[model samples]
Target: MTEYWRVKVDPRMCVRTGLCAASAPQEFQLDERTGQGRATAEVLSASEEVLEVAESCPIEAISITDAESGKAVFPPDD
Candidate 1:
């Protein structure tokens, strides 16, 4: 079975960099009015591109977790 991931973008931490949308347009987008990075959906099929986008966030605003297990995937647990 394909794994799924929960994607989240912290509005407080997001700086409207647009990197996430630029890197993974299919999975992320920038709000036109708020200009904040947001996940296209709360959950999506796991992919390396999504993980990369989360890791590449300059402010670490994006986070990903295993949808089933709720385990941290990006900014991995210490």
Candidate 2:
């Protein structure tokens, strides 16, 4: 059985800092018209690069979560 994860960016919260795209070029990119960073696709595996992107989001717009559990991974549970 394979597990998956997904990346979410809140459009309302995003300020287009470009950190997400810069940090995870393989996973995120800027929208052509909006110039805001967005997930290129749903991530199927965990990667430290993705976590760094989420953490670097100045507005905390990026989030990564278990596809099934819907629990946050990066930024963790404090």
Candidate 3:
């Protein structure tokens, strides 16, 4: 089975920097009109690049955690 993870994006904290989109287009996308980035998908498998982007978020709006264990994987700890 393909294990899945949970990803969250704080819409209010998003600054529309486009970094998340640039880093993980498959997971994050920026709205051209609003200029805010949102998760394209909520559930995903463990992706190193995606986790890196979450940690790199300037506003720390992005958080990734294990779907089953609900433990924080990025941004230090849950």
Candidate 4:
């Protein structure tokens, strides 16, 4: 089975701009209760949509990670 990537959300930083959802609707969702719809635990699908969303999150909560290696697709905030 293909491993899915991991995503970490800084809830404090998450303002719920919904850019990640708009960018990668298929890969991300916005939970009304949680108020943040980051990809919590998904195998690295590596679709253009998924990576684009991970890269485009305005609040920077959604991160696409390599399932096995746990490497983030995007670099840490520098």
Candidate 5:
């Protein structure tokens, strides 16, 4: 099975815009204290559409990671 990750926003890049959460409400949430976005999900479950949320990040702060491989699928440079 394709494992999912509890995505984390890069602090340096995150701007507290809350766009990721808006894009994928089920998978992500904003931390008002830190003004950062975090994954509210456990396993992405393939049917998940969080990738759209990650892409919506203006700074690309959101990352879609493959838990088993420990490799990132988005923010290609990372």
Candidate 6:
């Protein structure tokens, strides 16, 4: 079975950078009005590309969690 993850982009932390959308167009997009990165969907199929996009966020505005467990997947817990 394919794993799924919950994705989120913190608007407060986002600097209107298009990195997430550029890196993972299918999973992220910049809201035209807000000009902030947003997840295409709250939950998406797990993939390395998505994780890389989250990691590539300069401000670390993007976060991912295991949809089933609600465990942090990126920006790993300290």
Candidate 6 lDDT, tens digit per residue, 1-78? 239999999998999979999888999999999999999999999999999998888989989999999889988889
Model 3: clashing residue pairs?
none
**Residue 61 lDDT in candidate 6:** 94
In candidate 1 the C-alpha lDDT for residue 64 amounts to 90
RMSD of each: 1.4, 2.3, 2.3, 3.2, 2.5, 1.5
Write candidate 3's Cα lDDT for 1-78 as tens digits: 236778888888988889999988998898778988887888877788887888899989988788888877766552
Instruction: List pairs with backbone clashes in candidate 1.
Output: none
Cα-based TM-score, every candidate: 0.95, 0.83, 0.83, 0.69, 0.75, 0.94
lDDT for predicted candidate 3 compared with the true structure:
0.83
Lowest lDDT 10-mer window, candidate 6? Answer: 1-10
> Candidate 5 regions off by >4 Å?
41-43
**What TM-score should be assigned to candidate 4?**
0.69
Which residues of candidate 1, in runs, are more than 4 Å off?
none
lDDT of 5 by residue, 23-46 (tens): 777877888789687777655644
Candidate 2 has its poorest 10 consecutive residues by lDDT at 1-10
> Candidate 5 lDDT (Cα, whole model)?
0.72
Of the candidates shown, which would achieve the greatest lDDT relative to the real structure? 1
What ranges in model 6 sit over 4 Å off?
none
- lDDT comparing candidate 6 with the true structure: 0.91
* Winner on TM-score (2 vs 4): 2
lDDT of 1 by residue, 1-78 (tens): 239999999999999999999999999999999999899999988999999999999889999999999999988999
For model 4, the superposed segments whose C-alpha errors exceed 4 Å read 1-3, 76-78
Ranking by lDDT: 1, 6, 3, 2, 5, 4
